[model samples]
Target chain A: MIRPANIPRLLLTPAILTTVVTLGVCLVVLLVLSFGRQNYLDIELGLSAHNFELALTKPLILKLMGKSALIATGVTALSLILAYPIAYLIAFDIHKNKLLWLILFTLPCWISYLLRILSWKLILGYQGVVNSSLMGLGLVDQPIDALLYNSNSVVIALTHAWAPFAILPIYVSLEKIDRALMKASGDLGDPPYRTFLRVVLPLSLPGVSAAFVLIFIPTFGDYVTPHLLGGPTGFMVGNFIAMQFGASNNWPLGAAVALVSMLTATLLVCLFIAGSKRAVRAIG
Target chain B: MKNGLERWLVEELECGRIDRRRLLKMMGAAGVGMAATTWSASALAENNLTILSWSGYDIPEMAPAYFDAHPAPDFTLMGSDEEGFQKVHAGFRPDLGHHTSFIVGKYRDAGLLKPIDRSRLTHIDDFFPELEQIVTTDGKLWEAPLSWGNSSVIYRRDQVEVTDSSWGLLWDERYKGRIASRDSLEGLLIVGGLYTGAADPWEMTDAELEKAKDALIAQKPLLRFYWSSQTDLEQAFANGEIVAAYGWNASVAMLRKQGIDMALMKCKEGIVTWTDGLVMMSGGSASDDLAYEFINAYMSPEVGAFLINSYGYGSGNAKAYESVTDDRLAELGITDPDVVISTSKFQREISAETRQRYQAVFDEVKLS
Candidate 1:
């Protein structure tokens, strides 16, 4: 039998190794393809930065990437706000069977991601649940057409889709908090709000930070939600990438776009990590 | 009843005694596949005849008699010609695939397709002359013509007063926040070409392209969304969110069924039309004989009648119209093949550089 200390690392090795090998090869291939000239079926092997130049120099691509960043930022912020209360309730108010609450919270995740998004589509459609209810109640004469197929709908779906991810991390951080600190703060004649502000909030920053990163990165590259829900106005950089690879058959340009987006994501993640670490250290 | 001539021809071809040209010429004169297919009805040992085709083409309604005649081919539906091209290029070889005539040259050059044996197709002579001309290159046929249709402007009859059926209607400022457009660059460039009054919408000059891009960019704010699917377009139209958009004949047909008060416009600049059909893939496990059986089955007048009676697309086989009533043809807005061929701008293959530029320009308009 393996020692308890080594068990975590042992279990993690295969997953890590698999990801590294597969992703490493993919990244290498993508890089090579990005520099080659694309001629329909024939990709000539001369080194060229034309595709990169094409991808980066486009003012529209930059604008779309900016829109994607803004949308991802909104999703992260909304997820954090919506998830905090649930995580807090589960960690503090629900004294027993916390695992049950976590499961219930994660039940939406057990279903396929596509199905869940589709359900949201049905809900937010023109003659959807909300519009029908409003019409049935005699509050509106016609079904509201603005509920679905826009950037707002995209954000709403993404926030709902990623909320569980936010909840788990926040719950873990909140659960790991020492009870003695809260009691000690209360014993010093500090009110509950002040105690939470001083101790609980600062302690949960790591989890909040983790949850933000977890939601932000994937949401930035999300094309499916936008393509289905966002309509034209909601299209992001990811959809552009998909178009290049799929319909345009421009693998070189697609790879370049992917590389540029990855670099942008990496830079943002690093900055977030550094900033969050400093915030945690200063608070402690 | 198998004729002695057909038996001799089949045996001679099997024994490698004749060239494809001689066979085609003989078949063209005598109607070979039809005569042979009538007699050759036994099942082959092979189990699969894989087909990669459009979504509606795979449906039983399009080819009802085909399923009863032979074992069902594994159907993988394709959304776009480019997607089908890329899939086949990446080595996803189905026995037969649906592709546009414009890309036939590219696919043939890539060696992704084998030359279709016209002698094996019973309905080759039944195809319209316009379709026959498109499918043939250097007197060698590459694909079997299946269906032809127009890319038209679909608008609400109740809301929009579109008197002049022109591509310029999409750019109108009155329909701001009520326009739904396609995200496809090829489709957009076609519209752009029409807007700029270019004779050939598929091949635009740099100046014409600039004008197209400018016009699209100007119209960007008016669009509610750029739709990627039929479902997206239908919902938008149904809810009165979008009053006008570009769509195919099938989508318009579906929308009218839902009582959406939709009408397909016959643009003054002539609508952009695409002709797509089945081409034999180069590599497959199925024997040439079995593949020919499947092709011949699909080419029958019964299958042609099914295609016209169900979908709004024009059947490739001219004789299929013999089974369709005048009322049905009137309902579908098809006068005849000559009229559709004359009034529509059929797409030609654009150069790679032109395609790339169009993609870039469209991306600009969409993002801007």
Candidate 2:
């Protein structure tokens, strides 16, 4: 038997030690770097808020952040709607081979994300599968130019990439709900739709919120999806941050951008959690 | 090629399974020891030279003689000059880096380079006069001039009708949403600056920068997408998604080999002429002597011939011309050196401030 004091120390050792050494120390270094001046290969180490000033006041950066947030929110919402029905079927309708359906649904996640995005580019290109078939069938004179390389394509690719994540959590929540509640509602003469709205949805709020966060945070900082599919219009704040590290060679500016974007994401997530908890309370 | 087997033998000897004499006898039976000894006159010849270069520059065919003479060097291929610059600036130095001429001024100024001793490079004098000038900054040689090419509008001839071969073809309303441009800051700005009639595409004034920005913004809606890789542009052109785009000669040659009817436009406005060369970083993994050996091997006529035969890029060594046929030269668009040189405008070194401003303007245009 372990003492309670020793138990706390044992739990804290691995998690806290690793977190402090890896993230905490790196954050300190990044904080220092973000305030210094980068003069080509030489860093002056003079404390300055110039990087923040440059990054924050740029209208382009502001616009990219707003666009990124909006797209992330859109992806999360779409993933939820698309994933809900699949989760519902797996939880309630599917009796035999539920694991097989779940496995098949999440199978695309096994492939590399880059390869997946590239496949989307191929399938949606002007001379891609859909366009070639349509043109072959005499549906149109020329290849459809709007199939890929736009904001819509970015959202589509992101939604596809994150749908599996959305499905699993909602499925778990639905699986946990008691069948007795549904019977009780039916016994009380409540319609199936009303029972679903009042009982099923309320019980599944936690999973929906989990799915929302799982999709939103990653999509918000996604550089690859936008870069491959979004074209110029799809460029987000992450691309801006990447630019600072790459072509700019200004680590300070890149770190500043990262820190600011992280704070914004944190704030958004906090608000989302609080609002969702309230929504759950109201629904209950 | 003997480097791998020799390393295994050395490891075997170190493991005490075989004595040095026995190891040598086993290697003699395999006929590898004599080859290794004959290749390196000194046993202390650098074990490995790390070469950081663009994709095509690091191939075996490009440096066959060097591999034969010394141990095979490790190659880290980067996609862009900016990537190479960042890597070197961040203190990851390789024996030699293949960087474009435009970055030399900035990188040299930043103290990222070591001045090459031209005396060690036997083939330095054999380089073209234009290339010779590119490597020399303030009479101090900093880079080994290797290959040259142009960045121009490569169009699908079967899809689009060309009235005038000009940079304005990109801005033409007919090819709107079907044309592509490079997703690069300096290259696009140079094109835009030239289109807007700036005195110099590089080193644009504040007014010229604004004009360039407006010009790029106007052309953005017309673009299918800004391509960052030659493969992306090639795929786009191959599929007939984009009718025209600014691309390098290598991509044009690559697509043509695949039966894609691609043609590079001889724009009335000058094209972006660039030369890529090997610059030795100050803090390299290999010794200075070993680095120079690789550099000299790279500058030799054999490597030059390989580059021309394989990639269609003009070799820096003028002797490389003697190896290439007249028809191949014409096809590669360098039949007349004087005409090509006079018609093209080389990308010059821009200050970091100007580069940042150009990048900002480009980002704004791209996002807007």
Per-residue accuracy of model 2 over A19-106 as CA lDDT, tens digit each: 9999999998888888988776566676899988976887877888898899998998899999999999999999999999999999
Q: Which candidate number would show the highest TM-score if scored against the true structure?
A: 2
The residue pairs that clash in candidate 2, if any, are none
**What TM-score number comes out for model 1?**
0.86
Clashing pairs in 1: none
Q: Which ten contiguous residues of candidate 1 chain A have the minimum total lDDT?
A: A275-284
User: A205, model 2: CA deviation in Å?
Assistant: 1.0
User: What DockQ, between 0 and 1, does each candidate earn?
Assistant: 0.35, 0.46
- Kindly list the per-residue Cα lDDT of model 1 for residues A8-58, writing each as its tens digit: 999999999999889988999999989988786577766899988977788
- Write model 2 residue lDDT over B210-324, tens digit each, in one string: 9989989888778899987777788878877788998888888888899988888888887888887788887554688788877888888888877777777778787888878
TM-score of 2: 0.88
By summed lDDT, which 10 consecutive residues of candidate 2 chain B come out lowest? Answer: B12-21
TM-score of chain A of each: 0.90, 0.90
TM-score of chain A taken by itself, candidate 2: 0.90
Clash totals, every prediction: 0, 0
Where is model 1 more than 4 Å wrong at Cα? A1-13, A53-55, A137-142, A277-284, B1-47, B60-66, B235-241, B257-260
